[model samples]
Target: MDRKKFLKNGLLGLGTIVALPTAMNSCTKDDSIDATNDNATDGSNSSGSGDCTLSPSETAGPFPIKTPADLVRENIVGDRDGVAMLINITVQDQSEDCAPLAGVYVDLWHCDADGNYSEYGGTGMQSTNYTNVHFLRGRQTTDSNGQVSFISIFPGWYNGRAPHIHIEVLKTNGSSIRVTQIAFPKSICDTVYSTSAYKGTANMLNENDNVFSDSLEDNMADSVTGDTTNGYTLTKTIVV
Candidate 1:
């Protein structure tokens, strides 16, 4: 395991892409009087076969399905470049109400169109720059039931908070993980949550971004409207 200790344990093995969407409501309903039943469309199937478990601080592994694209941009600098955010991702292992997980492997990344980080956290190119640089690196695997879609654009506003994307959830046991990251498209350029570094990361996320202030990480709340003069389509899902 030596190659600088296997890339420093494969860039600290990224904790399953920062721990799968921090459960805010992976699949739940009853929003008081309702915000249109939270956009009702339950086709859940992250496939763990329902009854969530192993989600408390699960450390997947020293990651090694593939590593060394400049350490995968120094271990995902918010997954640079290909950052122009236009999305429509989906996945489900099971939340009970409706299951639909089929053929998994859904990994994604972000940072660009000016929010920087196309290769090394920001300001793209390296590894000899040119046969050397590859911005916003990407990977998409999931179909039949679990889904994935991407079209790209609108991902600016950086340096502090608001506009985000970072996800990782693998299958084949190891507690059938649900590591997470998802949130972006904050009402055109009103600059999300306004001022003070996006209201201090949306007020320290209720107290802290602790696994994104859970409720089963709410199946990773995802949304990004269209008509940036026409060009946007991003989608995501994973529960297996």
Candidate 2:
């Protein structure tokens, strides 16, 4: 669909699922954009499946594995100075079959409220100096099936954009390529998305939003219960 028309006609689901090997943004970023990283090894391009039937939902997770929430201390883990947002992810194959892909590492990164990042032990993210700390970001291997979870807060909106987070799925084995940036629901995202800056970039129509126009289900819809009003959840299948 044409850009203008597409924005207006956006996918129109509560969640925006992205296609494989999809990049959520065309807006070049300098924070950190390397498809290749230390945690991943399988760098080939393929859907995340391998005759495997294990799904993340079914797989045991490295963390306590809790539902996503935004309330203070509702779903808490990690250190007091640094709270992690837990993400429950699932991976699937082409046949629409689902399974837990274990030994896989999931990476996450998101801005804190007031729109700032915590660099290491810095005073959260508003400090003038960009510390080398990576708060609200972590990596954990999926258990037997394909389930991995995180403990974190609902990210605030920033610079004319929607409330969302950045993620990457990889073979904890350090080889498979990665998929990043799934979107959240507008209705639930109202508070953050309503912020002044987000409105400037809010998708007047889904089709108009450059990122939403081209995303895969794995990135957008991470779980079977895509209709939940809680925090974010989506699934992706990776192949090595």
Task: Give each model's whole-structure lDDT.
Answer: 0.37, 0.38
For residues 1-240, what per-residue lDDT tens digits would candidate 1 score against the true structure? 122343334334222111112223322232111111111122212222233422222222222223222322223334332212334455654454435565555455544445444434222332222223444444455566566544333444344334445556555332325555554323333332332222222222211233333322333343333333332334444443
Root-mean-square deviation of Cα positions for candidate 1 versus the true structure, in angstroms: 14.6
List ranges where model 1 is wrong by over 4 Å: 1-7, 12-37, 40-74, 78-91, 94-103, 112-114, 117-132, 140-161, 166-181, 184-240
lDDT of 2 by residue, 97-178 (tens): 4434566666656665545544422343244333543445566566676655555545554444444565555554555344
Strongest candidate by lDDT? 2
Cα lDDT of candidate 1 equals 0.37
Task: For each candidate, give its TM-score against the true structure.
Answer: 0.29, 0.49
Q: Count the backbone clashes (under 3 Å) in each candidate.
A: 45, 53
